[model samples]
Target: MDVRISVIIPIYNVERYIRECLQSVARQSFSAYEVLMVDDGSTDQSGRIAQEYADRYSRFRLIHKENGGLSSARNAGLEQAKGMYVCFVDADDYITEDYLCRLYEKAEETNADMVIADYREVEEQGNIIVKELGQPPRQGCMDRRQLLQALTSVGECHYATTVVVAWNKLIRREIMCRHFFPEGRLHEDEYVIMPLLLECGHVEWIEEVVYLYRQRQGSIMQSAETAMRHLEVLQTYQNRIALCRQLQEPELLQAFKRAYFWNIEIWYYLMRTRYGVESSRLYGVFSRRMWGALLRYHHVFGRRKTMEYVIFAISPEYYLNQYFK
Candidate 1:
């Protein structure tokens, strides 16, 4: 039987959550899908757990490789995908039982290369919150330009936001095969999403929550190291701007600038609050490069000129205290 979708899960040290994730996949109402669990050299029993699932289900397969981080694992899964559509699921997160069915239906109905769905953020401490639902104007025949405009205006419609999550969408396998995910990067989604959207041509937005993202205290996003990773994120966005400029996609370039500056503002706040004035090795380099990048992409600053001025004037500590508090 031909597979309709390939669900790729990159497993690391997620033993506690892997079972729930696999169980969710097993319960998926969409039967014409294969579950590929790529174990990225987990030191724990995560690999063993994945193997157990493979043994239990004929549709589940396990791929083991040396630890190469999240991007590498995803690329490995993409290389092995053999379905019309591909979807990513973090080992620690689970999806709705009808997730694949709904996303695939949307893709077929619209003849879209991708279908994105709304998702809820499961906070580590607080209650789960649903992000606002976006209703795409057209049910079918959504054009690339309209999709890009919708994504940029409403935020990254590719579901790259932690709030939106990459896992909540189903994309045509060819779209991913054509544009590989950049490996060895902390913010690979930031690097991959825009390019994929540009190449895919059309995307459908389904206003249903389909994935459950579990927020844990030990997750990288919540760790103290997140501040350090923010520096890498800034570099990724800078590269993204260069790529957009080379492609001569003016709208994408403007959108990248807006997202890039906002990220810088957040990073500066994080560094001040979490790392304080302690100068790390990358601190000086990051600060200088960030300012340079902002100036290079000066057009984006026109709308938020006051915000940029405030960012330049105040100490990071003050901004952190005022906003994050």
Candidate 2:
């Protein structure tokens, strides 16, 4: 069958929610789509359960592989995807019946290389928070520079800002296959999305909340072992700077620098907490590059928060205690 869209769901030990996730896909009004259940070496019944779906549905296929992280699982699914467009879904999250249809519609209508939709966060306590994750005037498409600006928007969290999530986006299979998430890294979205967007000619943002992001306490992101994941984002932000420089886009570079300072803020937060060891290692690296960061993002200090980063560059301890306190 000709697959118009490929839904790649990476599952590992999510037996409790895998059925519901698959159910959402089954509910979709759109056909001509294939589901790749990447059973990333789940020890629980998650793998077996997905196998059952494969048995029942002609479109659902299972790829059993070694216990690689999320990126590895996604990469495996991507390798086998035979679709015009692709989107990712976490095993624990569910989507609306119209999720794929709406995103696919936008892509088809605009001939966009990428289409981003807003999502609602469903907390464990049954509270749902609707998030407008993209920049405003959200119904239109953005060019390369506009996409960069939206991504680096100054907000607590929105679309491309802190909301650079991969799951809510529908990307052309051709564009997606050209770039990939780094294996074994938390916040893989941060590193992957910008480069992908840079290569895309247009990005369409629809304000529809078509996705349900389940926030659970037991998730890998909430685990203490991966708390140090915040530390790895430093490299991602630095890589973004390099990416911006490569494109020779001063405006985009400035925008990315503003976002990179957010990484500095996170490092300071980690330093103040018990995760000091990981933070300290980042601190040394930041210290050596302090002058460079200062020079690179100096234009952004006109804002109050960035002005604070001026002092943060001097002392992580002081920034953590006084200004950030």
Candidate 3:
């Protein structure tokens, strides 16, 4: 029996959470799907648990390899996937039993290349907060251009980062195959998602909550060191800019700017925590470069609302406190 969807899970040291994650998939109402668990060299008992699940269920398959980071694990799963559609689920996260069924129904109805569903954020202590970033359109069909415009204009729809979690949506396998994620990057999703969205002609939005994203304290986004690694995030934005230019999609330019500004604020916060006032010196250099980019893409902002330009105009430290603190 051919599977309609391949659920790819990249497992690392998630022994504590792996059981719940796998069980959620196992109990899915959508039966015609295979769970592909790629163990990325876990030092914990996660691998053993994965193997146990694989042995119990024919649809579950396990692949063990040396840890090459998240991107490598996802790529390995992508290469081995055999389904019409593919959706990624982080090993530590769990989905509603009807997740695949709901996403698949939306995709089939709209004939959409992608279908995105809402998800809940679960804190370490098991507190759950449902996040609905924006209201979905009533009835059917979302125009790709209009969606992009709304997202960019409101600074909401920008892809990249975990905001566009690979797992919360179902994507056509063919489309995913056309664009492979860049490995060897700490923030691979930021580098990959925009291109995927650009290539997708139609996207379906569903209001139902399908996945639960666990927010652990020690996650990369929460760490001081990872937050200080702002250069990598900036590089992702640069790549997006180059790609947008090459494709001649000028409308996306504002989205890129919004993302860059957001990164600047985050970096400033990290610097404040790590180096205090001394951090301003390093930020001074970054501010100059950002100013240049803002000027080059002046059309993205108006004269009156160019607060970023004004703040960054003075000095990095000035903008740092103004935007971040």
Instruction: State the C-alpha lDDT per candidate.
Output: 0.73, 0.80, 0.75
lDDT of 3 by residue, 1-325 (tens): 6799999999999998999999999999998999899999999999999999999999999999899989889989999999899999998889998999998998988899998876777986657964555544544565656444442332223232123557787999999987777777775766767778888898887766678888887564344444445457567666666766666666566676665656555555556654343554566557765676667665666775477656765676666666543
Q: Which scores higher on lDDT, 2 or 3?
A: 2
Rank by lDDT, highest first: 2, 3, 1
lDDT of 3: 0.75
Model 1 residue runs over 4 Å out of place are 123-164, 220-226, 246-252, 274-283, 299-325
Instruction: Give one digit per residue, the lDDT tens place, for model 1 in 261-317.
Output: 666666666565555534454456545655665556666666567454355434434
Single out the weakest 10-residue window by summed lDDT for candidate 3. Answer: 153-162
Residue lDDT tens for model 2, 123-145:
76536966554435547776677
- Clashing pairs for model 1 are none
What are the RMSD figures for all models against the true structure? 4.0, 3.2, 3.4
With candidate 1 superimposed using the best TM-score fit, by how many Å does residue 36's alpha carbon deviate from the native? 0.8
Q: Alpha-carbon error at 245 in model 2, in Å?
A: 2.4
- On TM-score, the stronger of 1 and 3 is 3
TM-score to true structure, per model: 0.81, 0.87, 0.85
Error of 2 at 96 (Å): 0.6
Candidate 3 lDDT for residue 132: 50
Alpha carbon lDDT of residue 97, candidate 2? 95
